[model samples]
Target: MKAADFASASPSAIRAMIGRGEWTGPTPGMAKGHVQANLVILPRDWAYDFLVFAQRNPKPCPILDITEPGDSEPSIVAPGADLRIDLPRYRIWRDGELVEEPTEITSHWRDDLVGFLLGCSFSFEGALLEASVPVRHIECGCNVPMYRTDIACRPAGRLSGPMVVSMRPIPASLVTRAVLATGRFPAVHGAPVHIGDPALIGIEDIARPDFGDAVPINEGDVPVFWACGVTPQAALMASRPPFAITHAPGHMFICDPKDSDYAVF
Candidate 1:
């Protein structure tokens, strides 16, 4: 189904389609008002440090829900959903190196693994759209561009790396409105971390992104950056944990709560 088809679909319905292998694309405009979360599964020993990492760097790694050791469901946000297969795609890490991109991780599941549901910026797109701010990637039907920056995250245990950010091209006129709209949902990355120049953030190329496809920025559009949940993947690369699993950039685990459920007011 095209992206519009999912605008009114329930979160569970989207998950079911993903689990059944019907839709495997990036989930930008899907399940309109529901929350979508970034996934991270780590061994019990590594979960603590990651939790700390999230706390220290909440802008890029806000915590949503975390499952108990040996469990696959994120009961707080996505109850009754299987973390192993509900997302469109996942990235497997071994000692910090990305080794596989799979649709489902059933074979890789472990009894000692713990799943964490991190707040995702995708949850705020509905707000942006409602506020009359355009999300270019969604308009172009592609993934939002993401980049790794020189800004360092406060280290937690052995996890340390540059912060990762997702960029959207907001028309010059709507920058403030976009910021104000997204600022209400702090649970899912609230507002633009930087607006205007990309160089100040160490992102050298706006046309080329480290993760996800680049979307066209119109003549009057200004590039906007937000702390991305993909920051953990950078942490994984730097820390080189023995085992880890995360959603592929642009892919997310849909949750049951409304986007308004996370709004501050």
Candidate 2:
């Protein structure tokens, strides 16, 4: 399908494309208006601790919908959507290391696995665009820049690591507008976590991001950072769980809920 085709497609239709391997790329601009989510599947034994960790670290790990152990469908977010094959790509972690990046995980799916869908910033990017705040990565046709920060998350059992942040260079004049626009969607990472000086957050080189592609920061733009959903993947790598699964950076699960459904006001 053409890029425009995917851009205008329905959530279920886009998922169908992913299921059939017709599209295996970042999902930032697809299924506009629908809420997109970050996937993190863990063994049942580890679910409770992860849930608690998410509760304590709401900025990076806003829980959207969780699945029953062994259940592939995210009944609350997208009743009939299957988590195993709906996303374009997935990262499989073993003993805290990413062992494989796969398009489908049905073969690896386990009966003891519980899926957690976290709110994703892509859900609120639409709001930013509507408010006339530029999303540089989207404008440049690249994945949003993400970096590992010095800020540490409160530990929950085996999940503890520095927070990861996604960066967008907003024009200085519209920084407040960008904040208010995204602030309305608390479920999808609410508002800006840090607003200036990448160095302050331990990011020495803004051009070299730890994950995703780096977009150019034009003159008059201020680097704005938001807590990222990928934060859990970093924690998993640190804790080195025997097995885990997550959406590949920039790839996401599209849900039936509208972005407005997650707005606070």
Instruction: List the candidates' TM-scores in order.
Output: 0.90, 0.93
Query: Which one wins on lDDT?
Result: 2
Residue range 62-144, candidate 2, lDDT tens digits: 99999999999999988888999999899999888889999999999999999999998887788999999989998888788
Cα lDDT tens digits for candidate 1, 1-265? 6766898899999999999988888886788888888888999999999999999998898899999998898888877999999999999999988899999999999999999998887778889988988888878877779998888999999889899999999889999999999999888889888998999999999899999899998899999999998897678667888999999877889899998999998
Return the top candidate by TM-score.
2
- In candidate 1, what residue range of length 10 has the lowest lDDT sum? 232-241
Candidate 2 wrongly placed segments (more than 4 Å): none
Clashing pairs for predicted structure model 2, backbone only: none
Model 1, position 204, has a per-residue lDDT of 93
lDDT of 2 at 242: 91
Cα displacement (angstroms), candidate 2, residue 110, comes to 1.7
